[model samples]
Target: MSEGEYRVAVRALCDFTAREGDLDHRFTPAPSAREGIAGHALVAGRRGEGYEAELPLSGRFAGLVVGGRADGYDPAANRLEEVKTHRGDLSRMAANQRALHWAQVRVYGALLCAERGLEGVTLALVYLEITTGRETLLTERASAAELTAFFEAQCRRFLAWAGQEAEHRLRRDAALRELAFPHAAFRPGQRELAEGVYKAAATGRCLLSQAPTGIGKTLGTLFPMLAAMPRRGLDRLAFLTMKTPGRRLALDTLAV
Candidate 1:
């Protein structure tokens, strides 16, 4: 959230750099988001009293802030787990998906070792079947140095992209701060609408405004929003419309 600092979740970092091969969803229907959450809870409930569930882990690599909650950890065993929910045969899961799962858990392993000051730790992947309540666990032992090396490798691959993105945001924010209205003057009621939008954005409030046709509502609204973006530290702006013509109108307004 600061200058030169790029934040990313642990799973996101692995997905961007560790994934390989085609993305195939044909093996089985994926579990719903709600089901996945419940499955994780069920797995956590089955653990021993010494088990810690939803363990928050974080580490920094260069300018990137990486953080996520590991699914479970057992201090007694010095083990960290990453739980995944699935509905079908585990053998049928795609190889790339499995590889990505290992990549994520290994990163968690590196973080856990660093946090606990361990020379090595056991990394686990716990797969739970939603309907059957079946659990399959795969685990491996990794030295802190090895896991750290892997973690740093992934981060090194991602830092270049993060740097480019940071630079783009800097340039964009600078440009947006100097944005101006496209036309020489606002139509009747347009200036009021623009003022309302600018105030709402600057103060982090929601706004609703109505203006008659030909009041130049699109430009009036968009220009103020862009002008307010840098002041409010907004990362992105989106314009949503209900129909094709509305989309085209907004696009044309942006073009201006």
Candidate 2:
């Protein structure tokens, strides 16, 4: 689907890819970046208190596991902080920001509570401007019970979404499998092409194919894809034939 038509989750994937690119350009260990972050904060707010950054626990898959990186967790302060970089003014701290930032921090807070002995943890969203270096800090508190309930809800939502995706895929697979090229036996390399197409479709990929005559190309490809529907969520595909006779042929071929 087009980018504009994509779901928010899909867009998030795109956003993540962009961030990965940024990390690639200047990849620095969280530990190494501590001084840098503190320095940036200092530059952003000369009047602010001393800025200190640390990488308590780092994992490449931490966000996927717990939701997002708990950039800084202060067991002493009973709070967590996430650093974000934005282009525009950093003075604006809004409500949506509060909820979203809290959700993320709760993830960290929950982790800290689980790993450490903290009962509850507060979260901070430290937004900093790229051009001006100005910064703003927004903090929200979340209890252990609150985080647990919220995370469970998140899991339910994710599962529901996954179920829908699976259903969509199954329907497409069924469509491909049930479609027939309107021929009896495989011709030349048609069997291989059909097999390849089926494999690609099953894995949810787009393919460009050229089939030779008498190979039952439509039937070969479609049948496999259709058959995979139950397992891979493959369902439907468009079958367009230029000739009126070809459409009839396609229908007849599937009968075999």
Candidate 3:
């Protein structure tokens, strides 16, 4: 947390900017979340004593925060890895997924290089199979400058979107601070609902409210959600409803 800093996770940055091509899960085979976690542990356990697992790392690119926990790092060997769990043919992975995986590791490599002040480092993708417990290793040696350049390119591609998001947040928060209640006064449970929404957004958590009808639910939720824009660093507030009528209610709430 610092001035002029745009906080972003390393995974988010790579997922956002490095994505291309249509979604094709036709060939890729992967394990469940729980299984993946176990697989990661298995690989980390097999590493040398000098290796560090779940290495929390971060670096900056023009105020954008790029951060992630690399699966493992061996300081002695100067290697960083991103562990992936899979089953079936690894060659079947889509090109887009491969590109994204490389992008993530490159950003991580740049972070590692910067943190260690090394001229270059080895980046690896360690894929472990859930069924056979076999591991596939893919690696590349990259200079710090090259990794930095790669990281910069990804950040640059996303910079404009980030800028617009930041600007929108400022405007939205300013409006919220000065926003007046749609009605002359609050309803019975509306104030509490609004407060809950604001606090949830501020804390970056979910809020579940259960109140009966006729409690100004629309305004209650929308108002505080808007008010929390700046503090929460929210790029957008999405209001999802099951039906068209509910969607209209949300839209009308905003218009008010």
Candidate 4:
């Protein structure tokens, strides 16, 4: 959230930078979120007493804070795992998905080596079938240096894009700070609405406001919200409305 620093979960970092090939969903339907959680728990329960579940791992690379909880780790075996739950045939799973899975575990492996100061670790992909409660594990032994190099390579790829994003944000915030209300003066009761919106945004609080129609409510809300965005370091602002007319009003206000 800070300037020059981008915080990303290890899985997310892999999902963004390591994913390759076309997204194919031709295989059987994947397990549900709840099923995946339960599958992970079941797998952990089957592990030995020395096994550590949800082990926290993190590392820094090129101003990026990358962190995530590994599914399970065995100190005795020097093994780290990433558990994935699925349904149907494993062979039918898309190559791209499998590659992404490997990418995730490798990043986790890199972080684990850094965290524990290990020379190397066994990176594993344990795929569990929810319906049958069966597990198929695939593993590879990787040295600390190799994993670290892989992690940094991915970070370098992400850093180039992140630098562009940060520059865009800097320019956007500067523009927002310099923006002024379109009209010369606020309509009656509109100033109160604008002030309330600004306060809510600045303080990170919820505000419930009600105003009658035809009081310049659209502009009143949008202008102050835009003005407050830079102060709060907001990355995005979403204006939701119930109907098309409401959306049009908000867009029309922006045009003015």
lDDT of each: 0.90, 0.55, 0.86, 0.91
* Backbone atom clashes (below 3 Å) for every candidate: 0, 20, 0, 0
**Which candidate ranks first by TM-score, i.e. highest?**
1
RMSD of each: 1.3, 11.1, 3.5, 1.4
Q: State the lDDT of candidate 2 residue by residue for 1-256, as single tens digits.
A: 3211222331232232222212332211222345446544554354333333443431112123323335555545665777666554433434444445555555555555666666677777776565566667877777777865655555455445545775676566566556555456667887798788778876888888886677667777666665666556333556789999988877776676
Compared with the true structure, model 3 gives a TM-score of 0.81
* Model 3 worst lDDT run, 10 consecutive residues: 22-31
Give candidate 3's error at residue 58 in angstroms: 1.4
Candidate 3 per-residue lDDT over residues 1-256, each given as its tens digit: 5667888888888888988897663444558889999999999899889889999999887888878799899988888899989989888788788888899999999988888898999999888888999999999999999998998998998888988976876777787678777788899988989999888888888878898999988888888887777667565788888999999999888887
* Runs off by more than 4 Å, candidate 2: 1-68, 91-94, 160-188, 196-256
Candidate 4 residue-wise lDDT, 1-256, digit = tens: 7666799998889988988888653456877789989999999999998999999988998789999899999898999999999899899888988988889999999998888889999999999999999999999999999999999999999899888988898899999999999988889999999999999999999999999988888888899999999999888889999999999989888887
Model 2 lDDT-worst window of ten = 58-67
36: Cα error in model 3, Å:
0.6
TM-scores for the candidates: 0.96, 0.49, 0.81, 0.96
Error of 2 at 38 (Å): 13
Q: Is candidate 3 or candidate 4 better by lDDT?
A: 4
Residue 54, candidate 1: Cα error in Å is 0.1
Q: Please report how far candidate 3 places residue 232 from its true position, in Å.
A: 6.8
